[model samples]
Target: MTKVINIQPVTRIEGHARIAIHLDDDGNVNDAFLHIMSLRGFEKFIEGRPAEEVPRIVNRICGICPWMHHLSSNKAVDGCFGVTPTPTGHKLRELCQTMAHINDKILHFFSLQLPISFSGRIVILRFGMSLESLKRRLNLQPRL
Candidate 1:
């Protein structure tokens, strides 16, 4: 006989996923596959837009990583322009991206992990304060 363990709707990731662990005849875990259920066609959508529009267009791919997408698209557009950003622009972009990642990490850690770590109403306040402060500092304009 075979057994399977499925974990659906995995939390705290960029998107939804279903993880299935296959079991051997004795029911021990043997294999696993992570299925991404939130796949989108952003590539196709951006294919024909003007190079200048690429950044804004691709930024809509996901609310979780719009900064990454925007940065990537900006790089691609810069390549098309046959010019690279100046050292100052590069530094500013890096700073903004770093801030975005820090904000995202804090949100994930607080909302997902802190609840299990601290069981109290204060956790909610902490999460809210952290998120709000990060949002203000990063100027994270939502794309979704």
Candidate 2:
């Protein structure tokens, strides 16, 4: 007989996902795979689109990475239009990119990194053990 195991809607990711483990007759896991069942085909749909439409189209690819998509698509638009972004536009774009980095870093620290680092029943204890060592590394903490 076959055995099937499922981890439904794994909670930690930015979006929904499913994990599957298939077991053979001896009940050992013979196969494991992860699937993101939802469709966000922005990357696929971007192909063959008009060059001018890239900035508007790709910007919606990921709500979390819109700044990156915007930056990339803006470059594509500039290339297609045979024009360069003005100095002011470049400066503004740089500021947005910097802000995006800050947001992503916060997300990593609070939601992903910190949780894993503090795992187990005595999470506070684990964190306490490393806190002093971590505090000493000026480079590890983000500069406000």
Candidate 3:
């Protein structure tokens, strides 16, 4: 006989998903796959869009797709219109985008580096292990 196993709303992701598994006659697992149920219509939302809205729309989508879609799209629109953004306008937008992306970079740095630092201290306290041993366990370096 065949069977269906369903898991709904899987965790640790931005959206909802479902996982399904199929089982064969002997009760051994046969196959499995994940399915995403949410669609934000991002493509449709962008079609026929005013160029000025690109930044705002892309900013809404996810973490970071186009870093400065608004400013970039505005520049493209300026090209299409055969005009230039004033030095002041361009610089201001650039500054704003740069600041936003920098903040994101700082957050990423902490997310990536802070845990490694703290984890080493934690391991040292708990197990009194050496860096070489930890590295070996993590497969980051060969055994000494």
Candidate 4:
């Protein structure tokens, strides 16, 4: 007799996958298979949009890596049209991409640490509004 062990919907990562392990009569590890069960569908999503608009539109695919998708789509579209960026233009985009990667890393690091450190404590997120304003809004500061 043989049995299969299935692990579905993997976590701690962006996408989905399934892993299956099969056992032989002896119960030792027989074989394993990995099945990718998720797709981003950026192709179908971007098909009807104008090429010029793709850089901005493809950005909606993933919030964390939007800048990478934005720049890559733009470069691919340019190549499709037989256009090449100027040396300075290429350098600038590369610089901006490096900076975007750095920004994403810092934000993700803070987010992953927030729950462990803060627990249920007062917290304010979102862009704009100063720390003092957030403290006041959340009533964390002592009343005057």
Poorest 10 consecutive residues by lDDT, candidate 3: 118-127
Per-residue error for 60 in candidate 4, Å, reads: 3.4
Write the residue-wise lDDT of candidate 1 on 56-89 in tens digits: 8888777777899899889989989999899999
TM for candidate 3 is: 0.46
lDDT-better candidate, 3 vs 4: 4
- Candidates ranked by lDDT: 1, 4, 2, 3
Maximum-lDDT candidate:
1
lDDT for model 3 comes to 0.66
Model 4 lDDT tens row, 1-144: 789999886543455788899999888889999888878788888887888989988888777778898899989899889999999999999998999989887666545434224443435455686878655545544323
- Pairs that collide in candidate 3 are 55-70
What's the number of clashes in each of the models? Answer: 0, 0, 1, 0
lDDT of each: 0.77, 0.73, 0.66, 0.75
Per-residue lDDT of 1-144 in model 3, one digit per residue for the tens?
699898887743455799999999988899998998899887687888886666677666555434565566667678867998789987888898888798666554444433344453212222476867756544533223
Q: Pick the candidate with the highest TM-score.
A: 1
lDDT at residue 106 of model 1 (Cα atoms): 77
Span of ten consecutive residues with least summed lDDT in model 4: 113-122
Comparing 2 and 4 by TM-score, which wins?
2
Off by over 4 Å in 3: 63-144
Question: How does model 1 fare in lDDT?
Answer: 0.77
